[model samples]
Target: MTLITDTISRAAITDSPLLATLAERWSPRAYDADAVIADDTLTTILEAARWAPSASNSQPARYIVARRGTESFTKIHDALIGFNQTWADSASVLIANVVDTTENTNPWSVYDVGQAVAHLSIQAQHDGIHTHQMGGFDAAALAQAFGLTETQTVISVIALGVLGNIDGLSPELLARESAPRTRKTLDELLLVND
Candidate 1:
């Protein structure tokens, strides 16, 4: 068993009030192939997204999940950018998040999909699952191959699973794999209510 060390704890923040553990969350690109995400866990993650607020509650967003070792996952993963393929190849599961724009005729179904993804991200953190939200796939290829309707919008593909060894990554990717998070300060991100 991998020793429970400060590094893992560092990956998952154990402090904070509103967010008890999400601080440790980051986009994961690698995973253990032997890992099997249970159906219950996937359902929990979807349930979190299901409750996300939507414009007029039309809830047009939908998810199609494919696990590792399945042809569906291969069909989708094969469509990823070459750079992503190197690390994402080992992901235990992949989720194709899509939006149906016609569900409500609302112009912001895409934005609602974003909200749903955000909810899923945080929920993954809470569930001790790692996630990487990727936008580097060929949408046209996926649409053509998956029989996606004209009214559907491909939002993004999310890789879901446990963390893996950074050493397994190529040196170029390793340099980026474990980099610390950077964010604009509140002063830069927040605006005074004028």
Candidate 2:
């Protein structure tokens, strides 16, 4: 068994107490290439997304799920650019986060998709898997490859898998992975209060 020496804790330093799942969630590029997520677990994660709140229950969120080492996965991964292409191969699954505008049916479609993805991320963290969402990809090509309609947009792709050894990452990636996590304070976020 190969020993993993990655001990960096990237948990969020929130001003107030947050759910452990939300506080502990952090994107990691290093994933065990050989890891395979069970079908049930994958279903559970999608289930969480399915239940996420949508404006007037329009539920515009859609997903194109692909497992590693498959044609669909290859197409999705190939659509990625730059650093995302470098390490995303190790992830066990790549999901295209789709938003169904359906002829401008929902003005808040993108916002609803974000909510669903947030739920998915939280559930994946709870399920002991890591997720890295990327917006740097060829949306047009992915849409063509997947035969998505103009109304259906693939805004982002999610790389999901068990965490791998930090030592396995390149020095640049290691440094990025080890960097401290930060977020805007509630005070900065709240401009006006009643």
Per-model TM-score versus the true fold: 0.89, 0.93
lDDT of 1 by residue, 106-192 (tens): 787889899999898888778878888999999877777688999876789999987776656676776666566566665685688
lDDT of 2: 0.89
Q: Give the TM-score (vs. native) of candidate 1.
A: 0.89
Model 2 over residues 127-155: C-alpha lDDT tens digits? 98889999999999999999999789897
Q: Which residue pairs of candidate 1 clash?
A: 11-24, 12-24, 13-24
Worst 10-residue lDDT window, candidate 1: 1-10
Best model per lDDT? 2
Candidate 1: residue 184 Cα off by (Å): 0.8
Candidate 2 wrong stretches, greater than 4 Å: 1-8
Model 1 per-residue lDDT at 104 = 71
